[model samples]
Target: MLDWTTVLVIVLMAASTYATRVVGFVVLRDRTLSPRMQAIMQNVPGCVLISVIAPAFVSSRPADLLGLAVTLAAAMRLSLLPTVVIGVVATGLLRHFVG
Candidate 1:
């Protein structure tokens, strides 16, 4: 049922993502990054994660907000896997009960 345009777009997107990573490795292969650059690179993933998730929070329903709050609380006290599990369970429960 997928259209040709959608398939082509998906293929191009995959290629572009692959090319980006390959280009990064090729361009940086012989160079040593500075400490400041390294620190910035280390934080990119977290910053990207926040940027992607922040919009969801702003537009979330009550159940989603409650789940996110529980997730945040769990994140403070637990590690990554537990926090994710807690978030998913809490969200599913809240959606079932509240929605």
Candidate 2:
């Protein structure tokens, strides 16, 4: 049902993902990273998380924005459980009253 270009693109993506996972082990098997590389690696997860969430924040409703603000603040000051609970409760309440 899929065209060749779509299939090729999907295959390429899968192969690239697989290569990234395997290449780290192959390339770094015997050596350690430099300090700069280590710092860059440490930041990768946060950068990726922001990349995934940035688009949603741009497109969200006002109520959702309020919820996200509470969530971000809670996340920075509190812990995961409280952050998630605050996000959910804040969004629900805002949606009920303002939405």
Candidate 3:
């Protein structure tokens, strides 16, 4: 059932993403970022996450909408890490059960 090309693409994409993150740390290893820059960097990941997830909100799919509702509820009560885990698990479950 596995498509080798799709699997290769996914592996390459994951490797590139990991490399960029690692490179960022290596490049910044000797430099001290300004407070403002640090704050901006801190929010970059959250902003990226929002950009990725925002389009799904427009999809009008029940599973996505309900998963978002669950994620939002989790976010209100949990920290960012747990919220992300909950959101991912909730979305997968919703998709399986509702679709």
lDDT of 3 by residue, 1-99 (tens): 999999999999999999999999999999999999999999887787677668778877899999888888887898778888898999999999998
In terms of lDDT, the best-performing candidate is 3
In what order do the candidates fall by lDDT, top score first?
Answer: 3, 1, 2
Instruction: Write the residue-wise lDDT of candidate 2 on 57-78 in tens digits.
Output: 9855888788778778887997
Worst 10 residues of 1 by lDDT: 47-56
Where does candidate 3 stray beyond 4 Å? none
Going through the candidates in the order shown, the clash numbers are: 0, 0, 0
Candidate 2 Cα outliers beyond 4 Å, as residue runs: 1-19, 78-99
Comparison by TM-score, 1 against 2, better one: 1
CA lDDT of each prediction against the hidden true structure: 0.80, 0.78, 0.88
Please give, for residues 38-97, the per-residue lDDT of candidate 1 as tens digits: 899777765754564465488558887887788778879986668767878998899899
Error of 1 at 4 (Å): 6.2
Q: Which stretches of candidate 1 lie over 4 Å from their true place?
A: 1-12, 74-98
Better of 1 and 2 by lDDT: 1
> Residue 84: error of model 2 in Å?
8.1
Q: What lDDT is reached at residue 16 by model 2?
A: 96
